[model samples]
Target: MSNPLSEAEDSPLFITSLAKGLALLAAFGAGRPSMNLVEMAEVTGLNKSTVQRSAYTLEALGYIAKEPQSKRYRLTPKSLEIGSGYLQTSELIERANPYLHELNRSTRESCNLLEPSGTDMTYVSRFASHKQISIHVPLGQRLPMYCTSAGRAYLSALSPEEAAAIIARSRLVAYTQNTETDPSRLAKIVRKAHGDGFACSNEEYYVGDIAVGAAIVNAEGRPLGAVNIAVPFSRWTLKDALADLAPQLVNTARSISNAARGLKPLVSPATG
Candidate 1:
């Protein structure tokens, strides 16, 4: 599909109702919910006319609803239907969850099933290892593309140009003293992870914690996401984090890749 911003201002394929509707659904995020027409227009870059129609259609479809007092649109619990339907049929999640559990049980550390979200990463599924002292990251927590092992693993799976774009946009915060904020250095690190088939981060996203991850890609080599095992600095140093968990994480991710052999890329044009 041509870049809608550059191509026909209103190509029907580009103006696809499904695409526009899903874009409206995606417009809601962690900080921004209950969007007024302007916020929705800004996020979707669609005209108020288009956004208004999309919102009304979504509300009628039970995917979104208008707030009583605010008069802004918010996704309903029914909005989960789209994601839940995908999860229900995706062999990747069903096959990968057990391995996350096995790794967590063996390592006694939290493990996750990651999925790419543009340049960022998110957990589609996870099993906690620190049940007694577990860091409970919910199902859809987003992590930085630059500072997270899961993010880097997904980055490592991208084409050089794609990965470079992600790195360039990242502010590369020094989440901890050990974080790598330089773009060139981070590129080299991602390149190394690409070559090594794994990635690791020590207190880069979460301070005092370390994670090692590996990417799972489809036959086209497009990244499906990744899996990681995380342990705290108090429980293990960076060296120990890699030494102890790297092999298990790699094994689990490979298993997911093996199972996701025919996975298709989700090129949601409007959202992408």
Candidate 2:
């Protein structure tokens, strides 16, 4: 498969410094929240001097900050503004918010709006259940597409070949005892989701987390994302949760999709 970003790198308009800065920012994640210049260079594969320059720029921009005692760099709350900017601008989130809240209210479970990112599904929006037993899935958290209900739902909306290609590219490691690591088995599950209009994860990604999801499609039937409701195993059985909540989840997904299609085009008209 051809990489669009790599292809763009050959364009004269491609800004190398901007790309390097973004890469430097991406280098600081959950596992590596705080990094020294050497660590940042190692992680981003940039030289020390380049990393230093980019780090200084990011620090100046308030996206990153250096610790006084450790001399390590960490992302600041200001960096969240970048993601917040996206959420604020997204029509999908706007359209899906009410439905997500409705699903959460009806199911009394944590509801999520997830979008596929390469081989993972990222939580873009969430409505936390007030119930005591609910699982907490924060926005921007990425889960393996191979073992998640949202990922499977998104896959189910794709063509068989496309879904297969995505699964082949995924690192199908067993996240839990229930996680189906075999490509063939995972494919079968995705096929079932395609037919059933919903996908289920029975403690696949996390041992105690059970979720059911349905794909949100555009007017062209292309998947925009997925809507998921998560419950803890201690409170509800997978069978009971699917039996009770599946219909509501599918309906909520459809409502969001329809609302999304009704919104005005995001692109601006070309001016002469």
> Candidate 1: where is the Cα deviation over 4 Å?
1-11, 16-18, 47-49, 132-136, 157-162, 165-179, 217-223, 261-272
Q: Tell me the lDDT of candidate 2.
A: 0.87
Which candidate tops lDDT? 2
Give per-residue CA lDDT, model 1, range 1-272, as digits (tens): 24535565466556566778888888897778689988999999899999989888888889988899989888889988877787677677887887778877888778888777655787888777654543557777788878889889888988877788777766677877888889988899999999988899987777677789899887778888889887777778878777777887888888778778798756421223
TM-score of each: 0.78, 0.93
- For candidate 1, the 10 contiguous residues with the lowest summed lDDT are 263-272
Model 1 root-mean-square deviation: 3.8
lDDT of model 1 at position 71 = 93
The best candidate by TM-score is 2
In model 2, what is the error at residue 198, expressed in angstroms?
A: 0.2
Clashing pairs in 2: none
